[model samples]
Target: MNTNKELEYCNVAVWFDRSTLHAMMQALVEAGLNVAWKESQKQFRVTVYTQHGTSDLTLLRLNGAYKLDELDYCVRDMRLALVLYQFIEQAKGHAIVKMMNQDKIVVKNIRYGEAVRIVEIKGAEKKVIYEKACSVTMDQVIAALKRRDAEERIPVMRLELDYELATLYDAIQAKDTAQVKKSKDRLKQLRQEMLLLEA
Candidate 1:
């Protein structure tokens, strides 16, 4: 897997069945996003293809994991979009549209108050992954659970929201729908935003 962001856009490279890859692909198609033409089926790519804030935000809600790198715009967004879509589906319970990238350490080379020191922003973007995956909370879990029959996979679908995912992973892992409302509420904002783009 590979990932990177440029000009409010992010790109990803993915392999088949390699964690959340499927979901990423579905999201792009479902969201009316496209795939890059340069890539072959063996190693595909996907990206956030719009400049609109809401569209971009919708694309950001992904639950995929394993970023190859932060993209440099040298590549096309279409391919990147397709690649990420695949990644989201494969990750399953481990998937989400956002994550708290705690490893960030940004420094300001300018003045103190005049220059805001950028730091501690969420890096593992679940929104992008989920959007790329084209998956809602319920569908993801259902698909992941269904995978168990194909092989020996576990029945779990981790959410792509911020706070709720932290709490929802266990619920999906346990196949418990008790907190389904909570997960929906946590993702309520993004859900509406994504739908608005489609409308």
Candidate 2:
């Protein structure tokens, strides 16, 4: 195992290091993701759990030979997949993460002594997100800072939405027409603002 470097935002912590097949699994567990693996008859059975759901997998060894296709695993939940993709930074030398309705974060294990390209894709649209090495460019640093900011803000915004929905539910049950109307209006405004953030 090599020394690991950490990057964190609130409750999310991602570590980067030269990773082996087994090391990736450990990294997942260290990130507070639930993971269990065992070997039987020389085959590895692994299970990963997230707030969304669970994913079970079988692998040959701890070698970087398998690719996780989202459709092949959990079709409705991507939290597990995203968590696994972060570990690929060390396994594949680099990895790219496409955050939902957000910009992509690129992680490279090896520095190329020059700028690395980062691209963003949505539907049929593609654009360059950043090109300079983060250590040498203020633009890259600013972008990273913005992403970190979003990481913190998004969860709070979601909590606000949840609270409003719960209040609205209680008002409806109580037959409070005025409160219901107010709650609905507040929910609409919050949703619109959240949509803007996603955009």
Per-prediction TM-score, please?
Answer: 0.23, 0.36
Query: Which residue pairs collide in model 2, if any?
Result: none
What is residue 98's positional error in candidate 2, in angstroms? Answer: 2.8
lDDT of 2 by residue, 6-55 (tens): 22111112222223456778766776778887765545667887665676
Error of 2 at 22 (Å): 3.7
Computed on alpha carbons, the lDDT of every model, listed in order, comes to 0.36, 0.49
For all predictions, the C-alpha RMSD in Å is: 16.2, 16.7
Total backbone collisions for each predicted model: 72, 0
Q: Which stretches of candidate 1 lie over 4 Å from their true place?
A: 1-19, 36-42, 46-71, 74-199
